[model samples]
Target: MRQGTLCLLFSLLLLTPRVQAEEAAPSGKTAPFSLSAGSQISELQQQLKESERQRDELSKQLQTASNEHETALLGRLRQENQRLKLQLKEARATATPRLLTDQQQWFVIGGGVTLLAALCGILASGGHRKRRQWLN
Candidate 1:
C-alpha cells in the first residue's frame, strides 16, 4: 500500500510538469501591463464611441432618405390610381355589346374547366379505391 501511494504521487508530479510545459509552449511569450496600457485602452474606448456616434448619424440620414423615397413612391402610385379610375369610368361609359359578349364567354369557359376537373377527380378517386381493395 505504501509503494502504491508513492507511485501514485510520483506519477501525478510528472504529469503536472508536462501539462504546465504544454500550456507555456502555446503562449510563446508573455507581456506585462503598465499604466500606459490603461491610457491606451481609454483612448481606444473614446475613439470607438466617436465612431459609433458617426455611424448612428449616418443611419439616421439613410432612414430619412428611405422615408423620402417611400413618400414619393406612394404619391406616384396615388396619381396612377386616379388616372386609371378616370380611364375605367370613360371605358365603362362607352363599352359595346361585343366587349360584354366576350366577357361572358370567358366566364363560361372558366366554369366549364372547373366542372371537368371535378368530374376527373371523382373518377380518379373511384379507381383508386378499387385498386386498393384488389391489392388487399
Candidate 2:
C-alpha cells in the first residue's frame, strides 16, 4: 500500500508541466505581448525587395549616362576627321606645282654634269692619239 502511494506521487510529479509563464511574460504590466517568426520574416523580405529595386534603378541610370557619353565622343571625333580631310586636300592642291618645279631643276643639273663628263673623255683620247703620231 505504501509503495503504491509513492508510485502515484512520482507519476503525478513527472506528468506536471514546468512553470515557464513568468519567463514568457512581458515586463510591461498594461500591454499584452507575443513573439512571432512569421512577422519578422515578412519584414525582412520587404526590405530585400526594396534594396533590389534600388540596385536596378541605379544600374539603369549608369547605363544611360554611359551611352550618352559615348554618343557625344563619337560626334566630336567625326567633326575632327572632316576638318583634317579638308586641310589635307587644300595643302595638296597648293603644293603640287612647287614640287614639280623642284624635280625639273634636279633633272637639268644631272643632264649638264653627264654631258661635261662625255666631252672630257673625248678630248683626252684625242690627245693620246696625237702624242702617238708625234712619237712615230
Candidate 3:
C-alpha cells in the first residue's frame, strides 16, 4: 500500500509544471508571474529621483529661512555697533587733553623741591674753606 501511494504521488509531481507549481502563495494570492530585472531597476531609479527632488526642496526652504533670520540678526548687530561707536566718539570728544599726567606732575614738583633744598644747603654753608673740610 505504501509503495502504491508513493508511486501515485511521484506521477502527479511529474505531471505538474514547475513554474505553475509556485503560482499560489500560502496567503492564497497569486504572485507576479514574470517580472524582468530591467523593470525592477527602473522602478527603483524613479523612487530615488523623487526622493532626491524632495530633499533638495526641503534644503532650499531651510536655507531661505536661516538666511532671513541671519539677515535680521546682522542688521541688529550693525545698529548696536554704530550706537556704541557714537557713544565712544562722544566720550572721547568730551574728555580734556592734559599736557602731563598726575604721576608726571608729581615727579616734576619733587625735582624742583630737591633742587631748591640743594641750593639752600650750599648757600647756608657759607664760602668758608675751613668749613668745607672733608674730615669734618
Candidate 4:
C-alpha cells in the first residue's frame, strides 16, 4: 500500500504544471503565461534614453537663461558706473580750484606764528648773556 501511494504521488507531481499561478487571479481563473522579457527590457531602455535627452535639453535651456540674466545685470552695472563717472566729472568742473588746500594753509600759519614768537623772545632777552662773577 505504501509503495502504491508513493507511485501515485510521483505521478501527480509529474503531471502538474511547474509554473505558479499569477497573483492577480480573476473569478477563480488562472491567467495565461506569456514570456516577453527581451521586449520589456528594450522598451525600458528606450524610455531611459528619451528621459536623458529631455534632461540634456532642460540643462541647456537653464544655461542660456543664466547667461542672459548675467548679461543684463552687467549692462545695468556698466550704465550706473558711467552715470557716476559723469557726475564726478561735472562736480570737478563746477567746483572752485584752490592754490593752497586747508591743510597747507594751516601749516603755513603755524610756521609764521612760530617765527614771530622766536623774534619776540630774542628782542625781550636783549640779545646777549652776562657772565657770572661767581664762576671766576
Better of 1 and 2 by TM-score: 1
In model 4, which residue pairs have backbone atoms overlapping below 3 Å? Answer: none
Give the alpha carbon lDDT tens digit for every residue of 4-40 in model 4.
9999999888766644433445887766545586678
The stretch of ten residues in a row with the least summed lDDT in candidate 1 is 23-32
What range of 10 consecutive residues in model 2 has the weakest lDDT sum?
17-26
List the candidate 2 regions with Cα displacement exceeding 4 Å: 1-36, 97-136
Q: Model 3: how far is 88 from its true place, Å?
A: 1.1
Q: What is the C-alpha lDDT of each candidate?
A: 0.89, 0.84, 0.89, 0.90
lDDT, candidate 1, 102-135, per-residue tens: 7899998999999999999998777554545566
Q: Candidate 3, overall lDDT?
A: 0.89
Candidate 3 lDDT at 94 equals 100
**Comparing 1 and 4 on lDDT, the stronger one:** 4
- Among all windows of ten consecutive residues in candidate 3, which has the lowest summed lDDT? 127-136
Winner by lDDT: 4
